[model samples]
Target: MTRTRTALLCAAALLATTLQTTTATTAAARHEQRCADTSDTRRGEARRVMDIVREAHRDLGLKAALVRVTTDGREVVTGAVGESMAGVPAGTDMHFRIGSVGIAYMGTVLLQLVDEQRVGLDDPVSRWLPDLPHGDEITLRMLGSSTSGLHDYVTDPDFLAQLDAAPFRQWTPRELVAFPLRHPLWYQPGTNWSYSHANFVLLGLALEKITGTPLERLLDERVMDPLDLRETRNSFTPQIPQPVLHAYDDERGTYEESTFWNPSWTTAPGAVLTGDICDLARSARAIGAGELLSRRSYRVQLDPGTVGLPGPTDTCPADVCLPQTEEFHFGVGVIVVNGWVVQNPSFSGFAAVQAYLPSERLAIAVSTTVDQDGASGNTAQRIAERIADALAPEQPLGG
Candidate 1:
């Protein structure tokens, strides 16, 4: 082989390598473009949603943002932006604490029992949880509807002080409920509407007593599996699954990772959960559609007799016992803002929302972790509100 012939072979090999590199780069760009909108069916609106998410990420000073919007069970746009940790890109599949979404799920389970004739909506809590104070007066409907009139234990000053003192302490349902029970009822049971963690916590206990099953296992077999929410699993402790979306907050005077903070006090033991954005969207649709409930049970879940309640009295402050009107009222475990069924939960440093517009069957779910001085407490819900405005202007979501 002469020098000229050898040089010609080397040049040909170099050209082939360059072409391969170019092709790879082009394919990568196309992949990114494809993810801009989840499906080709609604390219126009999905792109607008992607723009909203990017803008929110920048403006809100978010460390990570995950969103999924769907119409009629189909994806409009699903995306994740920012980092779970420095140098680690966020993804829609990473799990974060779902916060109050579990309350909605528990409500669904109670309705299921009603459908099965195992329990009646009006049955006194005394029937299942006779040990509870005022159990006879507080019925199942009241418990699920947040009209039980028990003050929210979360609002109690002592509970807040203890929580701040030991952020990682594991709390039992009874111990948490004690905070509210120690104080007198804000008003007679079932007289008006007021948010109360004790209602749900006691409801969880009643459910376990009635069903003779652990809430964790029951949720998996009934709600999570049936709805195809594979990633929505109850945590016994602070553990999150692999690919965790690390969270940070400045609540203790400095920004610190709080991903592993014990959330046992957030709700019932088996109901504390973590999930990715996709499951969050699916949950919104399930609750919005009443997919698992019978016609009668579903109707009650939406209204639950809270509407037309007389406005708050002297004992119950107007703010605490807010009026229950058709437009913006408490519907069982969820909130009805306009026509959107919603739950927005902020726990530790994690914030998330699951909002569904029943009229259009549109579901928007967002989960976020904020920077030290970034967005407000419920930044995920704020992002969802903007998406709802852009996609379904006629039926806006607010709380």
Candidate 2:
């Protein structure tokens, strides 16, 4: 029997292929889940979790955010919590830097172009942007997969100083590319995997060269507008609009206010978007159903599973490593968490997770602005697991 929340859930549900439902016992046992009709139940759980985290997590700040879940095109939960800042403003639609998560989404958009023959996956960087070292050797695929051998600009002391001094500065792809383009390859392209924003920065420039449009415009028209994601957008300018979240940095012993210019430097590397729980849930579902790309293009984004790439914690000897995967390899744009979950987090002030049970056509998205220990993937995983367990039909994990 469909519950009252089903209709509300449908409004926010993103498209996805149908999933088969197994016996409730099997569904419940396979994952830490619980069947409930009350969206309030999930919200309460998130609130409770946040209270504990805020008081104890190493990172002491938080932001306004929401979580949404859907099953077979039906919305299950939509709730926002916390204020953007202690006294400034509050809303579910506020935007924040998506950090590395932007890279994954960038890969998805680029692959879609490849699917349409608008571009090619194996195309060299030089084909689009000329006058760069190793332009002939670095391919789009290698850059997306983190095997491009480009050093990250963010690690440089000068880069960090600039970022700190001007957190709200708007930057262009050409300006951002200069950093890594000037450096020697950290390793042979395709020989290793390293997570560097520089790879995606270059990719963003290539995308501009291919489309003849700014990254923001292409992303908005192709991804957000089609989905009717009113609350999600790329803030290219330094002036943040209303209902924005205020970020903070613990500098030495003082907490300093920080603002992320969603466009400028971060662009394709990790900055083209900000969204609420509802839109994000819809986006995840759409991507999973192959709505954003053709089956061929979608396959490229999901290839981390088949290629068996090593992660940061993987037992690989190379400098570039695969992320630890208890389930499958990292897919193209997102990590395949525990065989079912997919998640992305920004270093700024937000983190998000999504998962689907193919058999049941059930999916869930959890997001938070809470930061834990310098954007540690391990911390994000723990938070994701907490929410996943609650959504599971079985008892929450751990006694």
Candidate 3:
């Protein structure tokens, strides 16, 4: 199977097998709390946008969903639906696991280091992670842009099996990278592009080694604190902080809570995080605007493809190394599609999307969780795409 398909299948299988069952009444209660006290502040199209979020959650059978949209960094509209847990109502302030959104933060920090001249994008990773396969040849740019050719351990059958066996197991970065490192490089470094969690894990480690600071602290100093994202913080344990937007799934044939499932396997220790929709919307603006980067650094962060990187090699076929198009291209840590810069991350029961339109200074952030029978996928991203269409009719997020 292709890597993306394999990863999705593993996630689906994981949702199916990981937890105990919940009663039908409890599941019903969770879904029934849709839009308990949804609030909106946008003018002209407030009700229209709020209706879209509410309808999408109900139609998609999401257990809980939160959405926030901002214009020029000012909150335009915000809404929440469904219960945080069986009987508790979800709110705009509820925190939920954000999955790979942390990848963007990693990329931003790397570019900040580049701006400071502490690290060079083209410098070999061997300078920090000398033991990695072909470490001497791989560059920081390759890791951040996902052109490093490292296998994604999340796609490894053995790793998936182990994860299924122990959903809450705390995985060290070494243990996670070992799975891909055990395999061969898909292609020579910078010769192709493929999304791999291993690349970010290594980049996180290298960042720590170079700065002598924890990844969480670096993120705070560079991105989170400066952006005033007080709600966003690393999750060192399985627990989602209080006022949690609990997630439920029927992947195992019965509705069950997967709210506190460990996410150590998702990314580096300090990179895995949970936050409310407000911070997500703010993050969309800050990261998208390159607010923390130099002009040259921001240019690289958004368009690393122009750095003369080679196309796909024979080993890295077209399916794995997708071609860049006007509507879609992978930038350093962001995905640019149809003039919108975006990041969407999905895990067991949670999914989130953050999208920014630079031309209009528009930002949309959505977080969602599936009901018992709802499909485990990118529900939030689809919802955000709809919202984007309504807000920016002239330039749809989809091409």
**Top model number, TM-score:** 1
Tell me model 1's lDDT, rounded to 2 decimals: 0.87
Ranking by TM-score: 1, 3, 2
For model 1, how does the per-residue alpha-carbon lDDT over 1-399 read when each residue is reduced to its tens digit? 699998999999999999888886774464344334444658788789889989999999999999988898888888889999999999876889997898888899999999999999889999888788888899999999988888898888899888878889999987998898898998888888889888888888888999999999878888999987877899988999866999998877788899999999988778898987888988999998899899888888889999887667999887788888888888778888898999888989999999999889999999999976887679998899999889888877765
**Of the candidates shown, which would achieve the greatest lDDT relative to the real structure?**
1
Comparing 1 with 2 on lDDT, the higher-scoring candidate is 1
RMSD of each: 8.3, 12.5, 11.8
* Model 2 global lDDT (CA atoms, 0 to 1): 0.59
- For 80-138, candidate 2 gives per-residue lDDT tens digits of 55666666544444545444445556777788788778877788989987777888998
Off by over 4 Å in 2: 1-65, 87-93, 99-101, 251-253, 260-263, 269-271, 304-306, 310-320, 323-328, 341-343, 353-362, 370-381, 392-399
Q: What is the C-alpha lDDT of each candidate?
A: 0.87, 0.59, 0.83
Stretches > 4 Å off in candidate 3: 1-41, 250-254, 306-314, 317-319
Model 3, position 101: C-alpha lDDT score: 79
In model 1, the number of clashes is 0
Q: What is the TM-score of each candidate against the true structure?
A: 0.89, 0.72, 0.87
Residue-level lDDT for 30 in candidate 2: 28
lDDT of 3 at 323: 63
